[model samples]
Target: MTDLAGHEGAWREFRAALASPRMHHAWMLTGLKGLGKGQFARAAAAELVAEPGIPQPPAEAHPDILIPEHPPENKDEAKKREDGGEYRRKRAIPIEEIRTLIQRLHTRPTLGSRRAVIIDPADDLERNAANALLKALEEPPAGTYFLLVTHRPGRLLPTIRSRCRVLRFNPLDHAAMERILRESAPQAEAAARAAAIAAAEGSPGAALDFVDQDLGRLHQVMLRLIAEGDEHFALRGELAEEIGTRPDRERQQAAVDLARAVVAAELGRGDARRNQAVIQVHGDLVRLSGQLPTYNFDPALVVMEIGALLASLAMPREAA
Candidate 1:
């Protein structure tokens, strides 16, 4: 019933650790994005906090579990009208919140002796917040458990990694990704579903996000552009005309994302020249994607440049 198709190994390893007489107080569920590390951490935390013979409560209502994420800057205000109905979530988890959670962790658990603190994507923690967390991890309470989920464990303090048992989650296989799509988006046409899975690169979350953005059509366009012997210049112009002409931020991002996916698909082949070109192009695209908000640049112009770059990369060198 649980969606852990590609992670049976991790599950077995966790279960083995649980069966041991001495249980670790801190666990780091670390892996690539969209591999369900947060989900697994929450499930384990719930199970850990549940009383004997009773099912774990929903994460939102679990008394023994505390999830401290990024709260809005203005804690009192529900939201600003112009910024939408709810206050925008802060960019980082503040130190005050982590301190509060640590204080609670040291106290006796209301539900039982066991308690859990789940920090999803712990990478978002600020320096002070991370240090606060590190202090708790250094000497956690007797019955407390810290479940930290991070897409990039390398970013965390080395001391924090040393204090926890690391569990790595790998990307799902193609078959498992397709199965998940079939269940989650059964209404999608067969071709669309296939495109979504291809774009996902074995991550169901990526597939869902792609399909939601209607990127299947863009995928087809990118595939044709990259096909062998294709005329890259003309294809680039056409793609720029189609995607770059729009000034919308979302559209521009989707166009760059599609192009990056193509580059990723073509990377690391035996062709050294092609690898270098795609890598450079992909890097520029990534940087541009990040800088879009800061400057008032024309989306079409940026994408056309990207197209031209890809074309140059695809061109065959002059015959020897």
Candidate 2:
């Protein structure tokens, strides 16, 4: 239960629930990406499984607490080069994991009177897996608690949503974000930190990403390209080559995110025609970003297209 910034209200609500005679068996912690919903879920679960007057054990060591992982597949099979020597692609929480969790729930708590299960970003549960989990939520074992952390609650089964008490975690404000940044990124330069804060738009996790990846430099390059427009084809080519072919996945993601933020910021400015152009580019960026992972499109081509979209923003308006 480390210090969690920008979630005092949620903490208070949770404490009140614990104090109540009738506590909720299921809690859905919902919020945007990079917020601390997952952290809060783990902390709450730890509290539930801890023995009275004894020090709480780390999450990994607690028998009464479970956080489901992507169950291992094909243990006999050797790693493939295409798979980066391992299965690295995003995977869903399969039905086997939920079934196992449910089996464990039937047993008595190992330490405290309560047992806890945390499904982080429960959004990753496969369809069958989610259904299996739904059954447990509907008829949870006595003294068992489920904490489901989700960035998009809409993706969850309606029945699951109905069963859980939803706790909405809001984004961190400037002060809270600063406190987190100071602690997590103490060595980050003031300029880089400021840029990260501005680009994060209230998500301390995202701010940390910007600082850790030195995305502020990338962001400045993006701004320069936007300001200079399509006149510099070579510059665009270089920019595309740099991010598109990089082995660093984090840099690629940061670039796409920053690009969208820049275009979104431009949407409300200028006249109707210019605003429309910005809107179109913003939509394109969103679509492209989504498609990149699913379709496995060439990264360089995507970067080039993104550059073209930014260039379009600088196009001159025809005389009225």
Candidate 3:
């Protein structure tokens, strides 16, 4: 397992739990997105199943560890194509997936005395799936440890939340973020790295994503447009074309996120009217961006809509 960065406190807590005579079977790992909560869960699971004097196998090769059938980050939605079908994007952990995991937990561990069940981002669980998982957590099989990763703990059932010990993961510090960036993207340009670090706001995963997709350039464009209003539609069209033309969901998400960040950076300026306008656009962006996944809206149209909202911030109060 890769060493998790900027989470030493969490590691120490987990290790202490392991060293205890009676370890908690269920642990809730809560944090913002891309803070390595899932990675920590996997490492902890590996520790549970690890034996003395034996080499640790990769997560997938371990028989005693179980993860969600479809990890949220990698899950895709199948779109009907003329040729047949192709996956685009999808989200959700269904009841059947949970049931399968539960059934497997009932069996004895294949490799060790303990088994590890990991639900990456338990927030993605459907209502029925969450209930089914709640039952497992309630009466987990002996020698079984459940590591639930949740970016939004509030969304989980109160009963489920009550059953497990919660470990909060905070954003990484600048030093930790830099160390991770060096390890993850050794060849990235200095400018790109700087942009990613600033834009990531202490999330290594988000930073890496920005670097991998070359989103720093897009972020710069957003900042420039926000700073200097696009009197003509030229800048907006260019940005929209760059993001909307690509079918990659990650790129689209990054664009929306960057735009929101740019607008949010303008908050708390001396001008109250401009601050209110920025606040409104930020909220609108959040709502509209959400619909992209739920309604499968056209990415181009969405970018245009975001552009329009952002453009409003550049307008003078006198013109309003």
lDDT of 2 at 147: 92
Error of 2 at 86 (Å): 9.2
Q: Best candidate per TM-score, number?
A: 3
TM-score of each: 0.80, 0.84, 0.85
What Cα-based lDDT does every candidate model obtain? Answer: 0.75, 0.79, 0.80
Tens-place lDDT digits, model 2, residues 1-320: 55578888998899899889999999999986688888788888887777768777788778888999874445422255345565553457888889999889878988879988999879889899999999998888899999999977887999999999999988778888888899999999888888888877777888898888777766776776767786758668767655656534456667777788778777667888888888888888877755554365566766788788887787775410
Q: For candidate 3, what is the lDDT?
A: 0.80
So what's the TM-score on candidate 3?
A: 0.85
Per-candidate clash tally: 0, 0, 1
Which ranges of candidate 2 are over 4 A from the true structure? Answer: 72-90, 231-235, 241-244, 271-295, 315-320
Report the Cα lDDT for residue 225, model 1. Answer: 64
Error of 1 at 138 (Å): 1.4
Q: Judged by lDDT, which candidate is best?
A: 3
lDDT of 3 by residue, 246-305 (tens): 556667777776676677778887387778788888899877655554466677777778
Alpha-carbon runs more than 4 Å astray in model 3: 53-55, 71-90, 230-232, 271-277, 288-291, 316-320
When summed lDDT is taken over every stretch of 10 residues in candidate 1, the lowest stretch is 311-320
lDDT of 3 at 249: 62
